[model samples]
Target: MSHILEWKTRLYLFEEDGTTKARATLDTGTTTLTGHGAAHRNPADTDVPEIGDELAAGRALRDLGSQLLDIAERDVESVGARSGERTDPVLGWSL
Candidate 1:
C-alpha cells in the first residue's frame, strides 16, 4: 500500500543578550511537538550572528528528531507490539 501524508515544520531563531535561541515546531495532523535550543557566544570569541543561528537551529532540530522517535516508540507499544524487539538490522537501528 502507498500512503501519502503531509507534515509541516516551522523554525524560528532570535538573538538576545549574546545568546541565540531557536524554536522548532512540528505538526503531524493529529499531534504537535515543539523543541527549543540556545547558543551562547563567549566574550572572548568573535561575534558571528550566522554561526550562532546555525548552532541554535541544528540543536533545535536534533531535539525535535529525538521527540519524534519517542513518539514512535510509544505508538508501537500502544498497538500491542514490543517497541524494541525487532531484529531486522534496518528496523533495529532506527529504534
Candidate 2:
C-alpha cells in the first residue's frame, strides 16, 4: 500500500546578546513537536552572524529528529511490539 501524507515544518532563528537561538516545529497532522537550540559566540572570536545561525539551526533540527524517534518508539510499544527489536539499514542502528 502507498500512503500519501503531508507534514509541515518551520524553523525560526534570532539573535540576542551575542547568542543565536533557533526554534523548529513539526506538525504531523495528529501531533505537533517543537525543538529549541542556542549558540553563543565567544568574545574573542569573529562575530559571524551566518555561522551562529547555522550552528543554532543545526542543533534545533537535531533535537527535533530525536523527538521524532522517541515518539515512533513509544507508538510501537503501545501496540505490544518491542521498540528497537530490529536494526534499520538506513539508520544503521536499532530503533
Candidate 3:
C-alpha cells in the first residue's frame, strides 16, 4: 500500500527597499514538487528582478523540503507504534 498527500504553499518576497519583488506558488503532490516563479520588476533597478526570482524560488523549495520531512517523521512514528518500537522525536527512528 502507498500513501499520497498533496499540499499547496505560497511565498511572497519583498525587496530590501520594502517593495514587492516576486511571488512563488509551490504545489507538492504525491511524489513530486513543482514551483511557479513570478517577477515584479522595479524600473529603478533591473537587478532587483533577478534577485527577487532567486529568493522567492529558493524560499519556496525550502518550505517544500520542510513539509516532506514532517510527513516522513510522522510515517516513521506510525510504523514504530504498530511494532511496539520506541521512536525518538529528536533523534528519529530507533531499532
Candidate 4:
C-alpha cells in the first residue's frame, strides 16, 4: 500500500557581528526535532550576509538529515529482535 504523509519544518536564521546562525525544526505531530548551525565571516573577507545565511542553513539541514537517518537506523535495528533474543551489536551479517 502507498502511504502519503506530511512533515512541517520551520527554519530561522539570525545574523549579528559577522556571524550567522540557523535553527531548523521539524514537527511530525507526535515528534519534534531541531538542528542548529552557525557561520562566521573573517574580518579580511567581505561581509556577505547571503552567503552566511546559505552556509548556516545548509549545515542545519544536514544536521536534520543525519538525525532522521539515525532514527531510521535505530528503528531498523530493532526489527531483528525477537522474544528472548538479544539485539546484535552489529547490524546484518558481516560478509
Which candidate comes out best when scored by lDDT? 2
Q: Candidate 1: where are CA atoms >4 Å away? A: 85-93
Tens digit per residue, CA lDDT, model 1, 1-95: 99999999999999998899999999999899998889999989999999999999999999998899777777777867655643432334556
Per-residue lDDT of candidate 2, residues 6-95 (tens digit): 999999999998999999999999999999989999989999999999999999999999899887777777877645543552234366
Candidate 2 lDDT trough over 10 residues, lowest sum: 84-93
Give candidate 3's TM-score. Answer: 0.43
Whole-model Cα lDDT of every candidate shown, in order = 0.86, 0.87, 0.56, 0.83
The estimated TM-scores of all candidates read 0.86, 0.86, 0.43, 0.82
Which sections of candidate 3 miss by over 4 Å?
1-47, 81-95
Q: How much lDDT does candidate 4 score?
A: 0.83
In candidate 1 the C-alpha lDDT for residue 53 amounts to 97
- lDDT of candidate 3 over 1-95, digit per residue (tens): 99877677666655655233444555665455443333455567666456666766675666666666666667766766433333443344553
- Better model by lDDT, 2 or 3? 2
**Candidate 4, residues 1-95: lDDT per residue as tens digits?**
99888999999999999999999999987889999999999989998899999999999988987898667666656886322223334455321
Sorted on lDDT, best first, the list reads 2, 1, 4, 3
Rank by TM-score (best first):
2, 1, 4, 3
